[model samples]
Target: MASSSSSSSLKFTVRRCQPQLVPPAIPTPREVKPLSDIDDQEALRTHLPVIQIYRKQASMAEKDPVQVIRQALSQTLVFYYPFAGRLREGPHRKLMVDCTGEGVMFIEADADVTLDQFGDSLQPPFPCFHELLYDVPGTQEITNAPLLLVQVTRLKCGGFILAIRLNHTMCDGPGFKQFMSAWAEMARGATKPSIAPVWRRELLMARDPPRITCNHREFEQVQDTLPSSDQNLVQRSFFFGPLDIAALRRLIPQHLQHCTTFDLITACLWRCRTKALQIEADEDVRMMCIVNGRGRFNPPLPVGYYGNAFAYPAAVTTAGKLCRNPFGYAVELINKVKGEMTEEYLQSVADLMVMKGRCLFTTARSYMVSHLARLNLKEVDFGWGDAVYGGGAKAGAGRFLGVSYFCSAKNGKGEEGIIFPICLPAEAMERFAQEFNLMLGNKSQPQTSSATFIMSTL
Candidate 1:
């Protein structure tokens, strides 16, 4: 129960069959394939769970989702053979796939509940999320474990929920999406995927004499300024619609009006979160922006190259400067980090990873945000059309080590917008909501001069 509130009291029992490994449809080559330096980073050696809910379609009323997906997954593994292998660690803690053709873990389940019973809002944190995709005990490790775990829970309403727990070391969000899309194509009777899978991870390998070119502030060690207690932390999702976005945009200067939606909203969240925590004004705070490097390269990585190709370029500033400064101040810091997403910067990161022994991103008084609203995960269809809800199973609550996601979702009123979840102590979460609501409701722009002193005390 990582849910934000206890109001989600709806409960149901699910009957699950024995878990089994589904190997590739045909025998594949057996060899050792090393992962890119970026892929073996300690920060990515964990599993990430994603859920997609599909409603029953009248045209495919008699089709069995479990069987279709099971068959499709086996066919998919033949091409994406790395997923059918197990991760192995070598000297200096480097990771590589053993190409064992051992296959992935799959489970079939039937839940005594309908899609509508989950409530009007299909957003996370979903009730009984863990049951939707059980960890299966020893399968949670990074090395010598199934690269992917999938559970297809058929609902009483003829709809089925597709839950997948993928090892982050294998691929990123976009990479995972590409794999799923190909699997869906197979389920739809495609003999082969439209786009072929490519394994040129060596392209992201570190240079012989690794060079640290740029300032890697994202990995800098710092002090944790907030209260040490992790208990009483609660997670909640907030919706920002067109009107809400308009109000937030009004807070920034007219010159920054053209800033992307992610820049605007993320800046606002960082400010509001800092204010709510009541952190010391002199302490430094950071906002780690996850930038995708696929398009940043000179010629770009190959299509269907499913690997970790992202970086967390951080923006650092003192709490006093951040909370008291004009709204554009935060936006400017974010833009600067995003602008640094070049081929050289990514190569520099690979060098840094190898040099630093693959350290985790700094979380000292920092908030991390990833924009997943545009991933079009909702469009993934396994013959039933779009999913009613498709994305991370849970938003906050340390599911992503305090990283919150901006997902595309429709509110209970059917208004489509961006929904993101934040985790904070109970009292801090209350204050955060108040501060955010005030900003959203205020039509006038903030006066930096007069509000500077007043904002720091918030």
Candidate 2:
């Protein structure tokens, strides 16, 4: 069982696990190559930094807290060796810790508000951890340790929120979650963690190198330089109640002739988005769905194989054709793409990594982003509660936007269904909402779409 503290200034409980005996070292040989040797230009871009924020009441933890956190961070770094790697092409990663030198002013009644309230109050042009870094033009060119920003706030009610930003390259969501759990365990004075960290690379190797069957080049996007335009990218959140999801589930069977929830909802959104954006008939539009690869591989992977364990199954259709058909047609497209999501495909993907002589995996930036999002991101939790909102680290990037949807089993209404963070043209977002609401027979509240709502709560 875990021990919990209910301080007026802090509302989180710590789970304590028994320590494990030190086991004899198991030496597993693996080969690791430098990023330059990988022949992947885009791959290098995927290693950008991540920003993290931590909030807490001024007096709740310790006096001179920056030193305390720095001390803890020093110990935490030992367990995360991936961060220790040197940047072969650029400067080393930088890890910075700063205090909320100045206190924040909140409306008096705001103290009782939940996480959702704080999220809603953020203005449209608000600064997420990423935006703060983006404002600095030359920051992206550097490759160092993840930029960790810790903000300690003193809430009127005494409790606080700890926000953490991590670079996607350091670890995927599951990898980061495990790291946090380990950190929390260490903070609570646990001598050992229930699950020891493993960094074996052989387990992730493909049986054959260059297992190519299909040409993946079609999915690649070439860029001479990063886009300078910052216009039209906006972030917005949408709430889908249980009834709304149930209606979608029912409609799938009636229309697409399928019984699954994901297929049905995805189809409907695709239709609405195409209609709203008023995309040209001949334009190529795709909806990329993430497929978890943990249990799908042959001789199933261990429960602890925590690196990237996902694949993208994308469905592409002309904007005009998609809008002209019934929602069921879109559902079939989803099913077809999903059918290709198998261990063979993943192995073949790995084979391509071997065949390309490790260069494709390193130089392919678009491939890295497209594939990294397929990993399981919904499992992160930090003791304040199971994550009601979890998503990719950064947002607003390419032609194929990424969206992830998950239901809250820990801190949301039982009647709540699924909430998705999506990215589409501004106009398309509105159409998606309108058509989605029509499918649910709820026409009262008009939908507003802008940028991808990276964080979501049901």
Candidate 3:
């Protein structure tokens, strides 16, 4: 018998129902090409692990959903062809997508548990969540890995969890959302996507001369090499309802120009995560933000450019200063870093990465944030009314991969709230929960300024 804490107690079992490999409708002109280091970097951004749940309801089509989704994906891949390709070895020991028209792996799984068993508080980095996602077991590298692998697990209650594992370099969060939405649309009988994908890799290609034209602080290489780290971290979900969000925003002064929801939550997270970790007073801290570069450009990326159009913009600070200071100061620091993510700066960042010939991001003393608050979860319908849950699967893996995500979900009143997920040390998590509850429960005090003391029960 499994232990009480074991996910086995949940009665989850994943077995291959059938081999479902769906390829594009058309044959691709055979071509083998080397992905530019920038493109290569994006391609290997992640195992691109994602897990979403959609409860079976009367609103869904009466037809077979597996077949419907499979057909839709097959048709969608005709336009988004790169997904059907597999990664292969390149000359420099780097990776490249071998554009051989191989289909994506689609598996059907069954679990004895019911969706109701999960209740409404479903979240990620769950104990058995890792088992739900499909990947090459025991390996994290994407080389020679299938570009896409999806597993659909049917629950006892008839609802299902759709787990998608893709190569991160294939698309950014926004781009992936675009592809999935179109796939959903095709499932609804659309001939083609409303906004056809634009696959012009050259838009992000390195320049002919590969020159560093402008200042690029984001790409500057670190002079010191940090030692290895592996903190036994656990992921948890933190939800902030409308009122809680408003209260947080109120904490920041309104007169501050860039004082938006993004800055408000970022301030809360940065401060709380820092204090939770109990970093030294002088220890460096930074919030690495993934900013979409599409709009920052003059002729913004075409509507359907389902490729990486985002840049990592980080805000650096010290742990003691971030936690000790008022929330307004953190917001200001965030806004300043945000203001620099202009078109000119984005171009320079590209040039700098091109000069370095590698795609890397800030690692040490950094807490990254990916705000998916704007993702329209309702549109991800595969003939169902809407997905019961649609958001990020795992924030990330390991301590060095410090990441926090702010996502959205529809509530009973058709309203949206942010779902922030993070993984921290067990002891830190205890402190974090106490500190967060204190901040949210302090409704009696007016959020005057950061200087005002906020008491905590912990």
Candidate 4:
């Protein structure tokens, strides 16, 4: 696999206009809004980078995507005004949104290349991502920084790429999807978003007296031994089409054939990854599955509540047991942990977060997977039809080790399937590919490659 910058041979320069602050079109109240316990977690303090590429469409050829989205963003901010505010920290590192309507950073640029030049597949890690979404200095801190940073780069072919640096402290993947869809609706000239934005952070607050009703092993402190240097790791995207999935399903027991796509893929990847890492036989390895808490509420959370509303329930086992057992073993462990996510479980997590002073999620020998396949990210359009690609700009969440995202995507050949970006050491990555190929019965070629690449190490 090639690095992000080296993946593409086409060289092009981007001429950028001065970045400006775009505030809400309408004035909002000057009040401070407290974030939910889940929103203020220590692990989510960094900004999440995302990208969307739009091709020139006949229907929208007459319009400028940058201008359209810029105007729409202002209008959308009226309903989702908190995005225009800056984050502030109180005593105990508690976070709050200072709703000053200060505005978000926006930039417009024109690239010399066209959409086709980016290669057949637009899935991440996208090449020249840093150029697409330049991180303006003094605007990336967790607090006292722009909540949203957007850069719209126009291509020579009239299509454009929309890149963003979103404050993870404000919302999770699903919540950000909602916000983007709403912004798209605005661009299409909707008077109001079909789903109104809601800000009831109090709903996910820790219970009174903060009781830890259930075990929260995902947050337990551990002596993390993962190497800090990214030079030892490489990022790559793997495609799982219908045939690939069917092949995996054959490994499971007949009774578990009805398992979900996420269940099957998570299990297969966990087994393959663990084997690739070659941890000690007795060492405990864990897989943390991010479960959305929206539906777990007795009465579901409001339709448009865009705060962090997810919990990571982990499945744990010894490396030897996980590797030696059949594939069904991993799936069962995943299914069991997923089943533990309930209303009570969410409350327990909130309590645990507060009790632990918002400690970071355990990273020791742990692989975290977040399923974005159901987030409806493909539906986000700024009047030029659905994007050619839209979602996380790269693999592995910002500085967090051993993180991966599963999303629905189309290949260069236009085949729709599940695509996941994995980052691992060069040696481990080669081993991972070999293990995966062995499962699929394709030993001829072990390594898988995609057009997108990660320029920066790790």
TM-score of each: 0.93, 0.65, 0.87, 0.95
Compose the digit string of candidate 2's lDDT tens values, residues 218-268: 244433232322344444444455566566666554545553566665676
Segments in model 2 whose C-alpha atoms lie over 4 Å from true places: 1-44, 47-73, 89-119, 122-142, 145-156, 205-209, 214-230, 254-259, 353-394, 397-415, 443-458
Give the Cα-based TM-score of candidate 4 against the true structure. 0.95
Q: Mind giving the per-residue lDDT tens digits that candidate 1 earns over 1-458?
A: 21121233466777788889999999999999999988988778878778899999999898999999999999999999999999999988889999999999999998888888777436665546667887687898899999999999999999999999989999988888889999999999999988898889899999999999999888899877566655566656777888889887877898887788999889989999999999899998989888999998879999989999998888999999999898899998887788888889889989988998988778788888888787878999889999987887654322334677887888756778887767677688778888888878853222111111111111
Which has the greatest lDDT? 4
Which scores better on lDDT, 1 or 4?
Answer: 4
| Model 1: ten consecutive residues of lowest lDDT | 449-458
lDDT of 4 at 179: 93
Count of clashes in candidate 4: 2
Model 4 residue 278 CA deviation (Å) reads 1.6
lDDT of each model, Cα atoms only? Answer: 0.82, 0.42, 0.67, 0.84
What does candidate 3's lDDT look like per residue over 405-429, in tens digits? 6767644344567776676666677
Give the total clashing residue pairs for model 2: 24
Model 1 ranges off by over 4 Å = 1-8, 396-400, 442-458
Q: Which of candidates 2 and 4 is the stronger one according to lDDT?
A: 4
Candidate 4 least-lDDT 10 residues: 443-452
Candidate RMSDs in order: 5.9, 10.5, 6.1, 2.7
